[model samples]
Target: VINTQRAELEALRKKESKYKKAQEKVSTNKLLKDEIEHLETELKTFEDKDVEIGSLKLQTEKLSRANKALMNDIKNEQKRYDFLESKYKELLVKYNIAAKDLEKKQ
Candidate 1:
């Protein structure tokens, strides 16, 4: 009877060890699953940021082109203003000369 009791005890110990090992495996699997989910979320966030960056870059390029065109227009307008100023000066001098000639005759 003592021998039979010893055999039963040993069997129970073996079962308990197997159960502990199974529990450990389950815990490890849960941890790995949670880690995978976290990584996936992070990857999605990075992809979204990449898309936003691309859109911003496109907008910056368009604005840069518009700025260059506006700069060229401003330069052309400056040249036109200078040309008009020179013509006005020349006309003023002629008018003054004509007025002096008239006063001398009188």
Candidate 2:
């Protein structure tokens, strides 16, 4: 029974402490009111920017992913172009050889 009472007392004390802090948030000590209000305003401003920062981070990630995908596509297209160019060069060589053979027969 004593242990249970102690635990309850501790819980109430924690709750009271939280309430006191909340009360201070609503109204601080008069002597430090101006300074505290300024600090609170600055803190609130930074907290408000949290969403904007998150959105910017998400946008940056998306753009980076898109850039990577585009680079890969460009690399694949370059490889395809190289393959076709090599094939064309090979056909040109074959045609030149055939032409030489025809000239010799003539």
Candidate 3:
């Protein structure tokens, strides 16, 4: 009877060890699952930010193009103004010559 009890106790101890090992495996799997979920959320946020950055880059390109066009227009207007100023000076010189001729005749 004593030997039989000893064998039964040994079997029960083996089963307990197996149960502990299974519980540890489950706990480790749960931790891994939580880590995966966190990484997924982080990936989604980064993707959204990347899209927003792309949009801003496009807007910056458009603004740069618009600024270049405006600068060209200003240059053209400046050339036109200079041409008009030169023509006015020429007209004044012609008027002065005509006035001198009229004075001599009088």
Best candidate, lDDT: 1
Better of 2 and 3 by TM-score: 3
lDDT tens digits by residue: candidate 2, 1-106:
9999999999999999999998887776664788888999999999889978999999999999999999999999999999999999999999999999999999
Poorly placed runs, candidate 2 (over 4 Å): 1-40
Q: Tell me which of candidates 1 and 3 scores higher on lDDT.
A: 1
Cα error of candidate 3 at position 91, Å: 4.0
Better of 1 and 2 by TM-score: 1
Better of 2 and 3 by lDDT: 3
Worst 10 residues of 2 by lDDT: 24-33
**Consecutive 10-residue window with the lowest summed lDDT within model 1:** 24-33
Off-target runs (Cα >4 Å) in candidate 3 are: 92-106
Candidate 1 Cα misplacement greater than 4 A, ranges: 2-7
TM-score of each model, in listed order: 0.72, 0.56, 0.69
Clashes of 2: 0
Q: How many Å off is the CA of 63 in candidate 3?
A: 1.8
- Per-residue lDDT of candidate 3, residues 2-93 (tens digit): 89999999999999999999999999999899999999999999999999999999999999999999999999999999999999999999
Q: List the residue pairs that clash in candidate 2.
A: none
Arrange candidates, best lDDT first. 1, 3, 2
lDDT of each: 0.98, 0.94, 0.95
Let me know the TM-score candidate 1 reaches against the reference structure: 0.72
